[model samples]
Target: MSDLLARHRAVMPNWLALYYDEPIEIVSGKGNRVVDASGKSYLDFFAGILTNMIGYDVPEVREAVERQLATGVVHTSTLYLMRGQIELAEKIARLSGIPDAKVFFTNSGTEANETALLLATYARRSDQVLAMRQSYHGRSFGAVGVTSNRAWKNSSLSPLNVHFLHGADRHLTPFRGMSDADYVAACVEDLRHVLSTVVGGDVATLIAEPIQGVGGFTMPPDGLFAAYREVLDAEGVLFISDEVQTGWGRTGSAFFGIQNHGVTPDMMTFAKGLGNGFAVGGVVARGDLMDGLHAVGLSTFGGNPVSMAAANATLDYVLDHDLQANAARTGALIVDGLREAAPRLPIVGDVRGKGLMFALDLVDPATGAPAPALAARFMEETRKAGLLAGKGGLYGNVLRMAPPLTLTVEEAAEGLGIIVDALETVNAEVTS
Candidate 1:
């Protein structure tokens, strides 16, 4: 482990964070569990940052990838027609919920957001964009520029004229004590104020995550985006849903997280789970905006046949098994379990999530302050107990939980019990 970590530090960026005091090197995964280099196994509650929507070692997805690999051509480069790519695009366009949607594929969520920004700016003939606070879009120059999460922003430079808004963080301040209806009203008013007074002119778009991922599964009330969308539409500003973490039924009740709001975004950017680990991502937008951008000579390796095959097969399994329903059922069971136990665990300051995506807001029990140290201890405890979780947030005190949508009820119970035990262990250690 030391040698591997030394090698990693030698080559990788210093800013990239790894979990645990001694990072576990995951060598292989199957179902919802992964094996470390030392042969210890962990039940993965984080799904590799929620990328593996289905699970690991899925036979259908693997066979599809193998079939595509056997085709003898790997780099079609979008210069030629490929049936898999075409079919996958059609499926995404239909699933996107944007009317007369057109699709463009990319290799990751960062590229997907970049494409969305380009399209929004080109269509509106403006560089101005609005993003959610306590949110993370991506790590690229433009994505980081639009992101409001300070921990992820390395530089102030950007290609777009960006503005930050009170998005999911309405749960944070100023609007905190208000009722749900009034909170939405307050945020809508905030949007109006920003557009009318702060932004220069003719804002291109507003991009947001239905639920903030790297910002620690933070989410707004049900109708927050719908309220914002009304104001944006009135001002000719397009709304883009960054579904990098919430897409493809991870949220349980809806096919896309945006659907939960009773509205549709003008454009949607997706990644993280579409290929179920095969590196596929994309944007779906209204035909007029997409055609207006032209986006000629877009990507060299985006939507390669191999990725499409994997994504198509992965999607098919999700649909065939009705994993959305499974996520809903199992997610509720786990969340209910957590809430029931939260009262006993004072370290759990807050328990929040939708479907499979959720967070345990760890806090100092004595002072009610964000406690990164306690969060770290809890994570280590969970690891020791054979569970792997994710962590992040503005204060780095939130523990993220997002198992595969394919999680079964029994698995959920096991993970929940492990979490309870970990919290108890950490609580005793801290109190002692």
Candidate 2:
């Protein structure tokens, strides 16, 4: 190990234990590839946890940043209106299909989610929020309260009235097994039961990730969002969709995750791909809810000029280049390839996701149980072999592949090949 690594290990706080230590020191990135200090190139499938929608070091994004620098105006308080912020807000509202929606910008996903939660709580004047089990909203205090992952909540045992809902339950699998009508009905019934029995009327907002990105990339059953909307509507609870990971065309969609289920959420939080790796996030809410919080809500760094300019450029590039469609097409190819390869590997349990976000569940060949250790080994081996993939799920058994939307088919294939090779190596070692 280098002296830098040794020093980091000795002095860094223990909270950084969540990430694995790699030998290589990545110095630069471009498109879907990253280069280490020694000029070794690696395919980056993780895309910084699905934040880099336009890939690394895109010329457009870089140019936008440079132009903002040239203007000598980077940061400004929301007390004064700025042209860049205004344009970016307008663009986001237009692209989100919610023209009248009001937006509150932030510097990160957690902040955006926190803003959404505060707005939701204020709007309904309720203390409780309902979130799904295995779902990850963010790591901040307010957002962490709603997250169901036990490991993430271990340190801060903050009090929160959060009810867990079973997501994409195979028993009620919509579009996977039953007819569309039956699937939709089952989902509706499930939501109704959760609302009346589990959450009741105490819930102020029901937050959900459209595709459950960190929760194993689990796609909710068809019409599930519509069902949840109905339940929330009946209870007069705000529906907040946390699109921190699944937004910004990463899921092959133009806007929020709720759109995939053909339902509109009362409030939406976006961050990951909003500025294409730049520090930017937003909380978009319905006109009524937004108006309710206008008096109390304030963020000093939100909607700054530089971040807004970057976001504007990102939105333009995404739309003009049809990156969402590209994600849809490339993602289909990757999923099909994985399906074709799954039969050859007995440990391959399941494959799920959409657009550029996908996951592969590793299992024990003999017992068909989740093999988290094997997944860890696969990540290590793949990283050694020049690919960067991530692990998700409560057990960390899901291999998460969320490459940038700009990733080409050839790059996707190369990344998948690395994964296949790593899986085979781990499986062989286990059998031996």
Candidate 3:
């Protein structure tokens, strides 16, 4: 490890995960790349966990934050109305399909999910919630309660009575071999049975990520959530889409990942890319649900002027450039390229995802077992090849790639080539 990495390990929590055996401290970034302390450039495929939506050093976002800094009012609590905050909220409300929507800002996805859960429980007067298996929301106690992943759930103690559901992850399910229509039907049946038999009472809400981010970029069959929405309507359970990883057109086909499911959520929480790396997150809810919280609440740093300005400028760039269209176009190319290349690679078992959000599951070529060690080796090799990707899964065998929406076809091809080369190199070494 380098000196900086040693310093980081000495002071930081041991539980805090870092990529690579010897973590490289990135000191500078440009459009689609970052330079480490050693002055080595690496193509940034993960884009800071998909937070840098536009790319590094985006002029609009930087200028907006710079302008806010010049104003000299860094923060004033939610008691004061700031123009940037109001404007950003309006933009979010317009984008959110919930009827008479209202926006409550937070400092991160964890807080956004926390606020949504609070609104949900208060509105329905129930602490019971439904969540998906292999799902991860945030690290907070409340968020962890609903998170079903064993690796991320550090504690069994939870504030809410959370139940895990099935169907989000095809790989982990016994029904993976079934056709899409049959698979969705099976999962929907399970959800209904769970609601009727397990809880049998008021379930405040069913919260799910459109694409299970940390659960290895796993996705359910299309229209699965829509089927669940029908059940939620009958059972009087609200729906919350945790779009922290899938929002702002990152999914390539939809501006919001829930759109692909063909159902509008009662409430939605977003973070990650909205502010393009600035600390910003929020919950958008229907008017009644939002107003149901009788207790007074205020976020200290939520929707502060700087974050609001950053979000405003970022959203403007996203909309003006029609980055969603680009995501669909180039994302299709990347997916097709990966699918075509997977046949030639021995370790790759699956390639799945939408738009820019894609994942490759590594497995033992002979036995078809998850190869997490191979995944780790490949990650280091990818870094050495000057490309940065992310790894996830309950088994830690999935390679995730979600480059900025602004990635050109040329960049996509270049990065995918590097990935293919890394896979080939690792395959040779592992087999040798």
Candidate 4:
């Protein structure tokens, strides 16, 4: 092992996962590329796990952070008024479509979701929560409780009682061959069954990601949540859209992934990409629900001026550049390119995602079983080709790609070509 690798192993916990057989430490980045400690450069297709929204070394964000630091008033706690915090909250509250919305800032997506769950349970007077299978929320105890993916969930010790419901993974579901209408109806019926038989009644809330990020960019049929929203409305259950990965126009089709489903959530939690790499996250909820936190509550570092400044600048950059439209256009090119190439590759099980987020699921050519080994080989080959990608899914066989929303058509083509080459190299090695 390298000296840095040895040092990292000694300092970090064993459960802390790192990518690749030999991990390279990233020293710096610009746009879609990052340079490692050894001066090697790689195209960053995963965009720091979809957190680097506008891309690396964004000038506006950098300047904003520098300006905040120059002020020398980074930490004033939530007790005192912070102009940056109030201004950022105003923007978020206005963007959040919920009527009479209010925003509560947090340090990360985990805290944001934790706060969302608290508001949900308190407002609805139920500790029970509904989540989707193959879903991942976060690593916190409260976040893990709702997480259904076994790979990431640490323990069963949780404050809230959680139930897992069927999320739309059409390829892996029994309804894969069914028509869209039929499949949605089936999932809705399953949800109804769970609500009635399992929970015995309405739960506090139903939380979901518009597109499953760590679950390999999994998507449900259109209007899936809208149907669920009808049930939630009837039962007076809150709908919490986990936009941690799907927010901020990354979905290309809409500003928020929930918009694709034709329903507005009662509450929405966001984190990734909002700060463009800064640790910024928050929840926007209806005024009544946000006010349900009866006792005194405040986050010490939730709305720090520095993070707020970074987020404000990042948001401004995203809007000024119209990166959302770019994401949609370039994402379409990448997906279409992969689909065209998929026919020749027997190991490719599926290519699915929205906007800039996508996944290429690998499987055994003969048996159609998830081919984790093949995915691993492809990942290594992609690294060799000067590309950085991510892998996820319950089986760990899905190659994930979520480049920055500002990705150009040429950059998308380059990444797609590298992926195609890597896939071919792995296929040849395995088939030989």
The C-alpha TM-scores of every prediction are 0.98, 0.93, 0.98, 0.98
Question: Clashing residue pairs, candidate 1?
Answer: none
Q: After superposition, how far is residue 110 of candidate 4 from its true place, in Å?
A: 0.8
- Model 4: which ten-residue window has the lowest total lDDT? 167-176
Misplaced by over 4 Å in model 3 are: none
Q: Which stretches of candidate 1 lie over 4 Å from their true place?
A: 171-173
Per-residue lDDT tens digits for candidate 2, residues 283-368, read 88887777886575667888878788778888889888888888888888888888888888888889877888899999898988
Clashes of 3: 0
Question: Which is better, 2 or 4, measured by TM-score?
Answer: 4
* lDDT scores of the candidates, listed in order: 0.89, 0.79, 0.91, 0.90
lDDT of 1 by residue, 1-432 (tens): 999999999999987889999998999999999999999999899988889889999999999999888988777888888899889889888888789999989999999999999999998999999998887889999999988878888899999888888867654668777888998888888889998898888999999999888888888888888888888888999999999889888889898998889879988999888898889889999998888855366588898889999999988898899888888899999889889999988788889888998889888888878999989998999999899999998899999999999998889999999998988888887767
Ten-residue region with minimum lDDT total, candidate 3: 167-176
Model 2, poorest ten-residue lDDT window?
167-176
Give per-candidate clash totals.
Answer: 0, 0, 0, 0
Which order, best to worst by lDDT? 3, 4, 1, 2
Candidate 4's displacement at residue 400, Å, is 0.7
